[model samples]
Target chain A: MARLVVLGGGVAGHTAATFAAKWLGKEHEVVVVTPNSKWNWIPSNIWVGVGQMKKEEVVFELAPVYKKAGVIYKQAKAVSLNPEGKDTSDKPFVTIEYTQEGKVGESEDVEYDYLINATGPKLNFDATPGLGDGSGQMGTNTVSVCTAEHAVHASHELEKCIQKMKDGERQKILVGTGHGTCTCQGAAFEYIFNVEHELKKAGVRDMADIKWISNESFLGDFGMGGLHMKVGGYVVSSKIFAESLYAERNVEWLIGAHTSKVEEGKIEYELLDGTTGEETFDFAMLLPPFSGVGLKAYAKDGSDITESIFAPNGFMKVDANYDAGAYENWKASDWPKTYQSPAYKNIFAAGIAFAPPHLMSKPMQSPNGTPINPTPPRTGMPSGIIGKAVAHTVCDLITQGEGAHLHEASMAEMGAACVASAGKGLFTGTAAAMTVYPVVPDYDKYPGTGRDTKYTFGEVGLAGHWIKHVLHHMFLYKAKLKPGWALIPE
Target chain B: MSIEEENFQKNDNFKLTMLPGAFAKRMRTCVVWQFIRFMVLNIKMLIVVSKSH
Candidate 1:
């Protein structure tokens, strides 16, 4: 029986492995190798960071779930890939180091007939000085909500800041990107507003000076170049929507910023205008930029073939048009449909692990030649869609034979619904629910805004907040592989 | 026209508002309307996911 091994158990990897296991049944083996024992519903991390939800509420043990699904689960991190096998054997395998209890640092080589590299971003806190120590972890100075543990810590720190505010101390809050190239501006945006909402509820809003600093050229860019949103009655740009939110909530902003360094209570940053400055904060939540979780590849003869498989950013090279150059020249066809590796027919990549053809935003550089633009956002929706699509292709290849055509799920052709929470109240809180048809805007399909106006829509209000709450439960239930889980579309 | 409702102008790009089954796409700020809109939008989102690929 052919073995299908998947690296990483994040949203994309877990979905692919689970769906593949169900589709292939007992005929083929499906193995999942990931570092974390718990599967994190990352979108709920915003609520956890603000102390509205417990860490356990956003995460669950993955071992039991995978066991129930009849899939082999390895709590380990992949170190390297040997697609052509080792010198001792011709069977292609991957070297994985165990991170589970009592087996830390222990390793094993497991061979596979087909492999899916869904090892999502490395967090790369080291990309910005003081965001982390030179080592690959978050530093002590600032807080992050990228993980369930980090969210709990951030919530504790925010509580301390709130207590200080209650003592009549004016706490300065800074929330935004840690580096220029960071994605997930929506998460950061959600966090800053959540903090604001919490402080207001605590009756210390007047004393707290909350500020947002991001790499987006304009507010509301949220990495997808700021679509035209239908707010109120008029069709204003997302920049306008975000600005109104900030203004109405009494929060301030500093856009076009790239955080350069972080200290105990201060941060140094460079703006797109080529000016450098420093800001002090009592509480800060800075998101680290993401890169591929570096995995090396070797030939059977012990030759390093890492460069042939991965992009410069360490992301696995897929069927995308990596050579697609310049912002003005990018086409909808630049995006990959099948996500299959060009060199290895048995290799595929999904989620953030795959290198995108280009940034969705109009790429820009600082006056001093430093690139300062938000990366394209592949949020939970697109990631899950890509995962399901990849699983479909792989299943077809195995069951329907090798000549079967692969299923396609291109970002340029698929729609995504992103509901960004602003506060966590059942009826009082607010959120912005946006639906963009074809996550990657097709300039050729629709002129001017490059999006189909009828299909692209958003609104911010209490109703949006309620939708966000429902989604939190719906997605978690779906991810746990509950009954009728497949009914929940990607 | 009242100053509060006067802020809402005609010719909004989206004829559909956040509330499902609500014909009015104009600005709504009343607590009563907000409650109605909440239920409507929640139902709409369910349909959105069900109908979406």
Candidate 2:
């Protein structure tokens, strides 16, 4: 048999196609494709953007969990990467399209003797200018919980700004990162403190006004360049634990910034000492900014090798050290331990679909130059431990053949464990949780805070909102392949 | 008064005057000290998931 496939079903393509279809069962042939037919659990889409969960409590229906994990789903949407096939099929394939329901756009191809990609990111909401809708989605004048129907349309625009602050009026709101190389500023910092804990649980927290905006040059450079942590026993420094939880919840910040534009309630910005401003609001959410969901590729006489498989901010290109230039010559061995694809060693790439080699924060700009930092986040628990270490090196190179041995996880040798939350009360909630360790920061093996301050610490109230509501029902019961779901780790 | 609101009013007056009683603020919803800090933060997140695999 020998097939594999797997493209994008989020959370690192559904943890590498449900652990490579339970380690290649039924003789071999996994499939997957993915154009979403519901799977979501995205960090509880920040408690469904504050209407406190319910979008069927964080999605599920991935065609009956890939028909009980035998795999072969394909709700489609890949579009290209013939690897080296067509000059009349030497067999590599990919193509895709569909998007389900009566084969929406219809187009196929399939083939593949191993190939993973894990096609994440592409919420590039038109990169900025009015934060998208010039055809790349989002844009209805700001709002996004980053799916789950944009967190049920950001809990109905934060319930019409909490019924216009229960009729008294005074709204404002805003949140963060619409551009300037955004990389999930911890999901807009857990959605602006869960919209200030649901406008102080609807008592209209003194008529609204919220704030916070990002691109982090400071205020907890969450994009990894700010770690130290520890907290209650002391240590500290995620910019003083995120400016002491946005000043003990009065919530207000701006940080380096960059936004640049977005109208219909105003925005614009610039900062990093270059000035230029504007801020108005009444409600916003922001986010967007992540590329590579483009795909393309080809070759075997098909010509276009799509810039030798991706990156120019389109991801893919794997096996790191992308000319590890500047930023004081970045190291921790320029990441990527074996996300493979150095010209297709049966291809790989997991999570935000690969490409990195730089920017664990510390890259700023703006003096009219504008670069504006913050990019490398590769989401939650290092995208499920680099999608189960690229599905254990493609199931040991398809059950030990071309000399196996390639499972390495490397985010400079793993270790991550966030929590975040900040509101969703079972007795007035809150959260933070945290942990760090190797998450890339080695500085020549732990010298001056390149992590491991005793597995980096952090902590906050109601037991981190009951461990973020028991990791939102234990990662949606380990992504619904339930019943012990391989003892739920990644 | 803008350098990001004077560095957010100097980190809100450096956390209301140099961490006076540095946060415990009522043992974070007390419920028996947050149920013994929710079992020591789930054994420190299973020892960082057993040292990340």
Candidate 3:
């Protein structure tokens, strides 16, 4: 029987493993190697950071779910990949170090006929000084909600700040981009609003000042560039909607900013116009830049193919046009339809593990020649979709023989729906529920904004807030592998 | 007040003035007549502009 091994158990890895197991059935073997023992619904980590939810509510143990699926689960991290196996064989084997129970740091080699590398991004907090402790933990100077543990820590810090405000002390709250080249501005956007909501709920909003800082050239450009949304009968861009929301909430903003350094209670920043300034805050939540998790690959002869297997930024290289230079020259066709690696035919990558062709926005550089642009973001929906597609291709190859037809699902041809919460309440609340068709811009099919106006729309009201709350529970239910789990999308 | 005196008061900055009950009734009728006259004039002007165009 052919063996298939999936690495990392994030959204991409979990989807690949479960789907591959079901499709291949008991005939083929499926093994999942990941470092974490629990699966987390990362989107709802925003509420946890604001003390609205607990860590346990956002994460659940993976053992029971894997047991139900009849799949082998290894609580271990992959160290290296031998794609050409040894000098003796053509089969590939992966080296992993267990991190479970009393077998922590134990190594093993798992042979596979096909491999899917859905290992998500590494949180590179060291890219900025005073941002992280250099050991994958947030530094004392600032707080982040990227993981469940980080959210819990941030919630405690936020509680302290709220108590200080209630004692009649004025507090300054700064939230946004930590570095110039950071992505995931949407998460920070949700967090800043959540913090505002919590402070108002604590009855000390007037005593605290809220401000936003980001590297986006314009507000509402959430990495995939600015999109048009229909509100009422009028068509308007997200820039206008986001600006109005910020104004209505009385939250001040600074765009096109590069946060250079973080000191105690203060952060030094440089604007796109070459002006430098400092902002002091009683509390802050800044997202660190993302990079590959640093997995190495070698040939059978021990020649290093790390460069060939990965992009310069550390994400795996897929079937994309790396030479698609400049923003004006980029096309929808440049995106990868099939996620097979160029070097190894059996190797595939999905989610944040795969390298995108280029940045969604026009590339900008600071006066000191440091490149600053929002990195392309592959959110939960797209990550799961790509994982299922990759699983289908792998299953076909194993069952239908080597030259079978592969599956195709390009990000440029898919649509995405995002609901961002401004506040959580039934009567006095607001949120922006936005749906954009063709997540990647297709200039030839639709001009100007490169999105279809008919299916693209956004509305900010209490109903939108309810939808966000419902999605949090719905996604967690799906991840738990509960009854009727097959009805849920990957 | 006489018609000449009433016209002087209406044209002044003081927007309101007291009058006898019978005189107030007559003033309301005159105001309605003046409004109808103004609307007819505007309609004639609009028709002239449209014809020219």
The whole-model lDDT of each prediction reads: 0.85, 0.83, 0.81
Candidate of highest TM-score: 1
Q: Lowest-scoring 10 consecutive residues by lDDT in candidate 3 chain A? A: A422-431
In model 1, the runs with Cα more than 4 Å from the true position are B1-52
| Best prediction by lDDT | 1
TM-score of each model, paired residue for residue: 0.93, 0.35, 0.89
Candidate 3's C-alpha lDDT? 0.81
Per-prediction DockQ: 0.14, 0.15, 0.01
Per-residue CA lDDT of model 2 for A39-112, tens digit only, reads 88888887888888789888978998889898989898998888878887788888999988888998988989
Q: Write the per-residue lDDT of candidate 3 for residues A384-490, one digit (tens) a residue.
A: 88888899999999999989888877888776667777665554555666777777888999978798776677765555666677678877887777787657654
lDDT of 1 by residue, A262-348 (tens): 999999999898999999999999999999888999999999999999998999999999888888899888998999999888899
lDDT at residue A190 of model 1 (Cα atoms): 88
The sequence of per-residue lDDT tens digits that candidate 2 reaches over residues B1-53 is: 32334334645444442221324667777789888988987887788777877
Model 3 chain A, TM-score vs. native: 0.98
1 or 3, greater by DockQ: 1
Q: Candidate 3: where is the Cα deviation over 4 Å? A: A425-428, B1-53
